[model samples]
Target: MDFEKLLVWQRAKALAVSLYKELANCGDVAFKSQITRSGLSVPSNIAEGMERFTNTEKRRFLSIAKASCGELRTQIMIGGEIGYIPALLADRWINETREISKMLSGLINRISD
Candidate 1:
């Protein structure tokens, strides 16, 4: 199956694209870079995992992607509190990360089985 066809991958890619566009004008370079990297990691890892030859390899990459979701969520919360991100946008991204994490978990479980 193509990774791009997966809903989780599509949503994850969209989230990363949104972050990059939204933070394009951010003044804090470090914060912007960190958040965007983590956001990008989710879909990147998912695609990499799906391309792997073995289920174990796929699960490992999916797990890493799931962890990246948590990392991105934390950054979003801090960015929102620090005014780097708008309250509503932060909330939406946070929810998206949560959903992405859940989807990754489902993929990992399916791979395991």
Candidate 2:
């Protein structure tokens, strides 16, 4: 399947872009990079995984992508707690990541089965 065409991917990509903007102003360089990297990684990994040569490979990458989504979730929570990210913004990304994670899980299950 073309993950690029998937609504989940599309939403994740938009979320990533918004996240990029959100983290850019964060004063801590390392924190911003780490969070942004993992945030961007979620959808990118999903796209790359879909293009893999085997379903096993796809599953592996998708799992990592799901992990990245989880990482993004944690980072957002931490950011909000630390006052780096606002509650509303954090909630938006959290919701987007949760949905994307669910979609990625469904894709992985279908590929595995």
Candidate 3:
């Protein structure tokens, strides 16, 4: 399957782009870099996983992508708590990551079967 054709991947990619733009003016460089890296990883891993020949490899990458969702969520929460990211923006990202994680889980299950 084409990764770009997957809704999960599409959403993840959009979230990553949004994050990059949102965090562009953030003064906390370290936090910004970390969150952005995880945001980027979601789609990157999904694409790499989908292109793999084996279901196991694909699932592995998908799992990584899913984990990155949690990582990104945590970062967003921390950023919001520390005033680095606005509450509304953090809430949006948190929700997006949650959806992405669920989508990844469904994909993983499909592949497993």
Candidate 4:
């Protein structure tokens, strides 16, 4: 099965939507926008990468996706610091992000080998 078809990606997309909702109305508009931007980047990159016809293109996009996840992780931490998000919720998102990053990395490594 195509990695793109994985339910994790679907869940990630759903999760990102919820995340945006949570961040959008939060106080501090600038920080909210930044967090929302980084949060959306994960699935956006994945969808773009999955659409590519070439493996190299897919790999490159996955790399970008992974990087965005890292960015999201940092934004989330800062969100927590600023009281934008609760620790429990932040931990949950971070774990999911890390899992997705690992999955993408595994797939990319397999492609390279």
Candidate 5:
């Protein structure tokens, strides 16, 4: 249950790091802040959830992380459509978020069982 050992957590962390680097040169402060915050939240929540003592607490945090995945995907899409993000890069981010969301679902279900 260690977050570091989780592939989803690792990807989420890498995504956040890449996002921060990508947004570093962005001229839109609002967009940059929103995406980066949500991106960071994914891994942060996963780690925090995995550290919880109860399944309920872990599920709650995982749910939040999943929600953040959705939020980040939306932001990435918008950024792409608006030309702030490259299409290929945005697509990659969206796909990664989707995978992370799925992973979180599996983890949540396993914890519930």
Candidate 6:
């Protein structure tokens, strides 16, 4: 299946785009870069994994994507605490990361079986 067709991938991509837009004018370059990179990694790794020929490779990439979800969630929390991200928006994004992580887990389990 194409990664683009996956709901998780689509959501992940959307979240990353939202992050970029929200942080466009952020004064702290380092924080913006770190958060955006983690957000982007979710969909990017998912796409890369789905395109791999082997299940092992696919799982590896999916696992990386799952890990990125956690990383993104952490960054989001930190961003919120540090006043970089708005409260509501940060909560929404954190929830999204959790859902995306669950979706990635499902995909990994399916591939494993």
lDDT of 1 by residue, 31-85 (tens): 9999999999999999999999999999999999999999999999999999999
Clashes of 3: 0
Tens digits of lDDT, candidate 6, 1-113: 98889998999999999999999999999999999999999999999999999999999999999999999999999999999999999999999999999999999999962
Off by over 4 Å in 1: none
What TM-score does prediction 3 earn? 0.97
The parts of candidate 5 lying over 4 Å away from their true place are none
Tens-digit lDDT string for candidate 4 (19-99) = 887776687888878777877888888888778888898889879988988898888888877778988998888888888
lDDT for each residue of candidate 5 in 1-113, tens digit (9 for 90 to 100): 67899999999999999999988999999989999999999999999999999899999999999999999999999999999999999999999999999999999999973
Pairs in steric clash, model 5: none
As a TM-score, model 2 comes out at 0.93
The model with the greater TM-score, 2 or 4, is 2
lDDT tens per residue, model 2, 1-113? 78888776788788889988867777899999999999889889989888898989999999999999999999999998899999998888788888889988898898963
User: Candidate 6, TM-score vs. the true structure?
Assistant: 0.98
- Distance from true position, residue 1, model 3, in Å? 0.6
**Pairs in clash, predicted candidate 1:** none
TM-score for candidate 5, residues paired by index:
0.97
Candidate 6 residues lying further than 4 Å off, grouped into runs, are: none
RMSD of 3: 0.9
Against the unseen true structure, what C-alpha lDDT does each candidate score?
0.96, 0.87, 0.94, 0.79, 0.95, 0.95
Superposition-based RMSD of candidate 4 using all C-alpha atoms, in angstroms: 1.9
Backbone clash total for model 5 is 0
